[model samples]
Target: MPHATIVEEFPKTALSRRTGDVLAAAATGPVCLTDHGKPRFVLMTMAQFERLSGRTDGRTEDWTRDLSPEEQALFLAEIDERMCDI
Candidate 1:
């Protein structure tokens, strides 16, 4: 879905109290979750994730094929690290 650049921000505690509201905001665009008054996390819908990850069908696009072996390994490692956070 197309969305505006505007991102709704909320403190981390809001996730515990206003969970529904936070999710509702995320449906429209990315939601910024702050920790200790500092921007920390972003929440987005699954469709946005699939689109950003370049997964149209069951498989993902081979955009990394052009990268060198070492570069691809480094990129894959970074992707693994980020996925662990989920």
Candidate 2:
């Protein structure tokens, strides 16, 4: 199991910085960010991002490694499930 970090982007950090750090952490765990006292975005690691982006590294991608069709599908499903509440 992975440990997630939910951060309120107000007191100590801004949305942009947290957003960057969240990407790295997202590869390892879920990073939930908030704005205006409400949850606004969810971030996940590379694998999770890959599932979501279908591009191996989302928009800021630097490298590429193809995922098997089955693996990609499975991971994409996991990302979906992770994003769900209840």
Candidate 3:
């Protein structure tokens, strides 16, 4: 069975009136905004969105790519030794 998600629900009107409070709640976790007693939207922190969407700073280059051939060989040898230990 899938686990149920516990969300904080707020009516659209209430969310509009208490925007600050709603945003504060979203900072902790997702908040379900409801319209007519049904979920209409989800509010979450920017960090949460980034995490869920696999968003990064666009600096995902491999450090080994810039290394000298000798350095690369040494690094690979160290990694192989470490993996063997595990």
Clashing pairs in 2: 26-44, 26-45, 27-45, 27-46
lDDT of 1 by residue, 1-86 (tens): 43435369999899999998897677655789999989998887554466556654533237556777555545544554576689
Better of 1 and 3 by lDDT: 1
Q: Which ten residues in a row have the lowest lDDT in candidate 3?
A: 55-64
Order by TM-score, highest first: 1, 3, 2
Residue 60 shift from truth in candidate 2, angstroms: 21
- Please report, in order, the local distance difference test score of every candidate based on alpha carbons: 0.67, 0.49, 0.61
Order candidates by lDDT, high to low: 1, 3, 2
Candidate 1 Cα outliers beyond 4 Å, as residue runs:
1-6, 57-86
Candidate 2, residues 11-68, lDDT tens digits: the string is 2245465654554444445566666667677755446555455654353222223665
User: Could you tell me every candidate's TM-score relative to the true structure?
Assistant: 0.57, 0.34, 0.55
Q: Candidate 1 or 3, higher TM-score?
A: 1
Decoy 1 TM-score against native: 0.57
Q: Model 3: residues >4 Å from true position, as ranges? A: 1-6, 57-86
